[model samples]
Target: MTADLTVVHARTLTLDDALPEVEAVLVGGGRVLMAGSREAVRGAAPGARVLDHRDVLLTPGLSEAHIHLVTYGFSLSQVGLHGARSVSEVQARVAHRVLNTPAGTWIRGGGFLLSELGLGEYPSAALLDEVSPHHPVMLYSRDLHMAWVNSAALRAAGVHEGTPDPEGGRVVRPLGCLLENASALVARAIPAPTEAEFLTAARAGAQDLAERGYVSAHTMAFEAPDAPRALQRLAQQGELPLRVWACLPHERLGQAQALGLARTPGGLFQWGGVKFFADGALGSRTAWLHAPGFADGSGTGIPLDPPELIREVGRAAIELGLTPVTHAIGDRANTEVLDAYDALRPQAQARGIRLRIEHAQHLRAEDVPRFRGLTASVQPIHLQADGPMIRSLMPHLESLSYAFRSLRDAGAVLAFGSDAPVAPPEYRANFAAAVTRVDDAGERLAPGEALTELDVLRAHTRGPALAAGWDDEGIIRPGARAAFTLWDRLGGNAQALVF
Candidate 1:
C-alpha cells in the first residue's frame, strides 16, 4: 500500500550511532521512511509535504522512565507543598486549603521533606490539628512512603498512640504520622475516586507529560487498579497523548494470570512488568539499610518485600512473560534485590526479558557491577533534594548515592524519570540535577558521578526505550517511530512533535 508522506526538516539528532545526525527526515505511515539531507529525503519521497523547522533541534521523543500517571494527574489539583521550608509554612498552606474546602471533606497534599522543614524530629499531629481541626488531613512526605495526618484523620483511621505498628510499616508515637504500610491504614479511609475521576486524572497526567516533551511513560503501578483501567480507556478512545508502559502490583499477578493476560503491546498502552517494593524510601526513614544506618540512629531502614518473596513472586512473574521490576533504594535493599535477581537472571535471559531494579538509588561499590545487564530505572531529579539528606543522614554512603556514572560504566541501562507527584516530571529539573550533581545545600554529592548533557538526554530517551523494549521509538532512523521532540537546545525549552 502507498504511504502518506511528509518531510520534517530540522537540526536533527538521530541518536542512531550509525547515522548520528541528519538535516531532514521523511516520515510516512507513522514511521521514518528516510533520514538524510533535505534534498535526499525530498527525492526519496516525491510529492511529500515539507514541514521545515530549521531553527529547532529535533531529537527522538523523550520518555519518563518512572511515574505514577493517574496519581500525578490528581496531584495537579491537590495541595502542593514541595518547597515548604518550615512547619508554619506547611500549616499555612493547609489553612488556606481548609478555608477554601468544605468542613467534612478530607484535605490531601504532599511534597515536603522532613529535613527541609527544619524539624530535627518528626512533627506531631498537633501542628496540623492547630491549622485544621474539623477536616481530616493527610500530608504525605516528599517520598510518599510516609504520611503526616491530623487528629481528625488519625481518629478516622483508628490509629492512636497505643496502636501496634503493622508489620513492614510504622505508626509513629503521638499519632500524627504513619510510615510504610502504616500509611495505608489511613489511606484506605480516604474515599476512592470514581471511574470518571480516574479517567480525568489519567488524561490530565498523560497530557501533562506530553506537554513537557515526553512522548511516553512507564507508569509504575503503585496506584489503584482503576488507574490503568482509565489509561486503557483513553488508549481505546484514541485520546491518550503519550504512550504508556504500565505495570501491575505483584499482588495482582494471580488475577492477571487467571485473566490470561500477557505482554500485549500495541496502540498507546501496554502492560509489561510486575512491580515490587523491596524497601521503603529515604525521606520516610524506612529505606532498608545495612549497618550503622541513619546518622540519627534510626536503625537500618525497614525492609518491605523479603528477598525470599521477591525471588518467589519475581520468578512467577517472569514465567508469565513479565519483567520483574523491584524498587530498591537503600544499600541493603539493593544488595538483597541483587541477590534475588542473581537466581532469576538465567530465566530472564533465556526468555529475552530484562530484569529491572527501580531506584537502585544507593548501592555498595561491589553491587554496582551486578547491574551490568539490568535496567537501573532511576530518578535523577530526586538528587536536587536528597543531596543534603545523603550527606547528613547517610554520609558514609554519600559517594554511592545516585551513582549514575558508575552504573553506566558498568553497562547498566540508565532510565531517567521524575517519580512525579513525588517530584514534578520536569525534564529540565532532571537535566540540571543529573548534570550538576549539586543539592539544595549548594554542595555537590559525588561530582565524579555527574553525567554530560547528552548522557542525561540518552537516559531520558534511549534508556526508557530499552526498558520498554521499543527499538523503534528513541531514535530518528529509517523505519523508526515518527515521534520527535523539538528543543531550542538540548535540555532546554522543548515540545513534542509526534506525527
Candidate 2:
C-alpha cells in the first residue's frame, strides 16, 4: 500500500526549535507522520500523492485561545457597531438597522468603546432614543462590561430611574447603561436565535476562523449554553472543520457535574474548562482596580463574580477534571483571582489541570510573578484600544498593562487571541499589536513590554496548546496534529489547512 497522503517540496517550519526548518512533511491518520528533507520523504513514500508548495512557508496552525465562537458568528447577522467612532456614529448605525428591521423587533450589537465614542461622561439612553424611539435597541461595549440601551428598550425591560443596581453590577443613573449582570436583564428581553440561526452562526464563526488560518479555538463560554451545544452538534455531525475546546460558564458547573461531564480527551471537540468572570472590562470602566482609579475620577471599577465564588466552584471543576478559567481584567480583580488560585494551586496541580486567566490585562507589580505556570489567555489586539484607556484611567499601572514581556519572563504561558466579535480574530492584528505595542492613538503603552515575532508566534501557537493540555497540536513534528498555517511571511497573510 502507498499508505496515506504526502505534502512534498514545501518550506516547512517544523517549529521544533532544535531543528526548526525542514523541506517537506508527510501526513497519515490525520497527524504528521514525518517532517524533513523533501527528498527523504519522497524515498519513504514513493507512490504517495504529492502537494507541491515548495515556496510557501508552513508552520503549526494558529489557535485562538480565547473566543466566543458561536456568538461571534451570530453577531454577524445582528446589528453591528464595531467601528462606530462616535456616539453619533453608534446612533446612526442603530437608526439604519432599525429602519430596515421589522417593528417591535429587538436590536442587538456590540464592539464599541466609550473612549472611542469621545464620551468623557457616561452616555444617556436619550442619545439613542433620538434616532430610534420606536425600536428597542441594546448595544454592548466591546469589553462586554456594559450595555447601552435606548429608552424604549429600558422600559421594555422594566428598568426605570428607580431600578436598583444588581449585586456585582450596576444599572447606571442615566437609565442608558447597564453594567455586568445588569446587562443580562436587558439581554434576556431579546429573543433567542432559532436553532437554524444558531447553526448558521456556528458555521459563520467557524468559517471566519478558518479563513484567518486558525485550525482550532478555545471558546470561552460567555454566550448562552445553547451556543456550545450547537458547536458540539456540529462536531458530532462531522461538519465542524476546526478543533474546539469548549467551556461552561461557572454557573453551569453543577449542572455539568450532574450530567457526569468530565475532561474529554482526543476528538475534534472537547470540554476542558469552566469559565468565570472576576470583574468587568476597562473600556466600560468596570474593571475592578485597587484604589485611586481613573485619573478622571471614575471610581474604582465594578467587580463581577467574586473570587470566593470562583474558588468554591473551582473546587468542583477540579474534581470534574475541568480547568478553572476566569476573566480578570483589573489590578484588584487579578489580585483577588490570584489569591484564590494560590489556595487552589495544590489541587489543580494534583489533578494535572492548568488554571487560566482571561485578559490578565492590568496587574499589581507584586502579583506579576505569581502568574508563572498559569495560562494567560490574552488578546493582544485589544491593547490597541486599551493602551490609551490604561494611560488615562490607570496611569500608575500603565507600565504593567498587557505586560506580555514581564508575564512571559515570570514563566507564565501566554496564549494570544483576538477575542473575536469583541474584535475581529485577525491574527495579523494580533501580531502587530503584540510586536509593535502600539495603541489606537499611536502611542505605545509600554514599548519595553513589546514582544518579537517569534515570541508572539509561540504564544499564538504553543502557548494555547499547552493551556488546553494538548502537547500534540501546536508543534509541527512527528506525532503532532497535521494542522498548519501557511504564511507568506511569519507575520503576514496566511491560510489554514488540516489533514
Candidate 3:
C-alpha cells in the first residue's frame, strides 16, 4: 500500500448536497480522490491502505468555530469549576488547589456560574479568604467576563474601595469582584506564562481538539500575542494536529496594517479575520442590553468597543481581506453591531468577506433578520446554563434568545462553537442542547428554535468552513481535504480520520 493513498470504507454522510451519502472514499496526497460505492473506490485504489469501518459513520471533520484555544489549554491544568453548584463548592475547590500550591503563590481558576452558585448577590472576598488566605485566588465566572478574587488578590492588584471602575469595566464594591475590562486589573498582576509554556499550551489545546474529532478551528483573538505565535510555531514545526484559522484583535489592526499584513494563506495556520468586542458576556451581568437590563437590578450592562470604531475599522479589515468578527451577546449589542454592519456590508460583499458575529446570543426580533447574510457563530451548549437566567433576567427577549432556527431560516450561516474555557468543546452537548432545547433547570428554552441533528452537523462543519473561507475543508468532494470524523453513530463517540 502506498504511504499517501488510502481507502476508507464506512457509512459516509457526505455533507455535499450533490452527493448526500456514499459507501466508501478514496484519499491520496491529503485530499479526497473519489467517494462512491466500496467496490468502485476499491477498484480506483487497488494498492491503497484500506481502513474498514463500515460499522461506523463517517462525515466531514468537525470544526470548533469559536474558542480561546490556548487559554483553554492552559485551563486544563488549572482548577476546573464548570459545575460547582454552590458557593461552598467553589470555595472547597479553591482550598483543594491551594493545599498543594505553595504559599503566597497566585492561584488561577474559573468556570462557575453566578446563578449556579446560588448567591443572591455578588460573592464577597471573605468567602474565598475563609478557604485560602495565604495564597491569592481568583476564579473567573464561566463566561470569563468576571473575576472573583479574594481580598489578598485584590490587595496585590491595588484595588480599593475608592478605586474607580476602568473605562469599560467595573470593580464591584465591597471588593470581591471585577467585571469586564476590570478583569485585566487583577490579571496584570499575575505572572505571564513563558514562551515555552505558551508552546506547550498550544500543542495541548490543538491535540485535545484533534482527539475530540475536530479537524479545524477558528480560534478567536482574545488571547495574549504569544498564544497565536505558539500555534503558528506548531504549524511551522508540522506538529499542529488541527487546521487553524485565527483572528487578530482589533486593537492590533494598525500594527498589522503597518506590517503589511493581509490574509496569509496555504499553511494549516492562517490569519483569517479581525476580532472586535461590542459587549461582554451574560453570566457576568455585563451584556449591553436595551432598557431595563438584568431584571436582577444590575443596571444596563457595559458596552466595550464603540460601534463607530467597528464600522470604520471593520471596513479596513475587509479591505485587508480579513473578515470583521465581533462578539455581541446582548440584544442591544447585536442591534448596534447590525447597524454598524449595515454600512460595512457593501464593502464586505464587494470583497467576498462574510462578516462574523460571535455569540449572537440574544437578539431583538428585528436584528435576527439583520444576521441574514452574516455568520452567527453561536454556542448552543450555553443554553443549558442560561435558560433560567433568560427566564428570570431577560424574559422580555426570552423567546428570541439563542434563536438558531430563525437565524438559519433568515440565511445566516449557523456556525456552532464551544467558546471553550467557557464550555468544553463537546459537540455531543451541542447536538443535545440544540436539538433538545433543554437547560440545566430541566426547562425547555424556546423549543421551537431546536435544530435537527443534520442541521447541527452542518453548522459545525460547513458553516465554520464557509466562515473561514475554507472552501475545501468541510465537504467530502473529490477536491476536498481528506479529513473526517468517525462516529460510532452520528453525534455519538467521535474519532478523527485524517489522511
Task: Summarize candidate 3's per-residue lDDT along 410-429 as a digit string, tens digits.
Answer: 99999999999899999999
- Residue range 394-461, candidate 1, lDDT tens digits: 99999999999999999999999989889999999889989999888899889999999999889999
Superposed model 3: Cα runs more than 4 Å off: 1-3
CA lDDT scores, all candidates in order: 0.92, 0.88, 0.93
Q: Per-residue lDDT for 1-499 in model 2, tens only?
A: 5656766567877768876989988887788888888888888888888988777878889999988999999888877777788988888888889889998888889888888888887799999899888889988888777899999898888888888888887888868989888998888878888988888899899988998889999999988877888888899999998999988998888888889999999888899999998888888888888988867787888877888888899999999999999999989999999999998999999998889999999988899999988999999999998888888788899989999999999989999998878998888888999999988889988899999998988899889999999999889888999899888899899999788
Using alpha carbons, what is the TM-score of model 3? 0.98
Q: Give the winner by lDDT: 1 or 3.
A: 3
Model 1 clash count equals 1
Clashing pairs in 3: none
Which number leads on lDDT? 3
Q: What is the lDDT of residue 36 in candidate 2?
A: 82
Query: Model 3 clash tally?
Result: 0
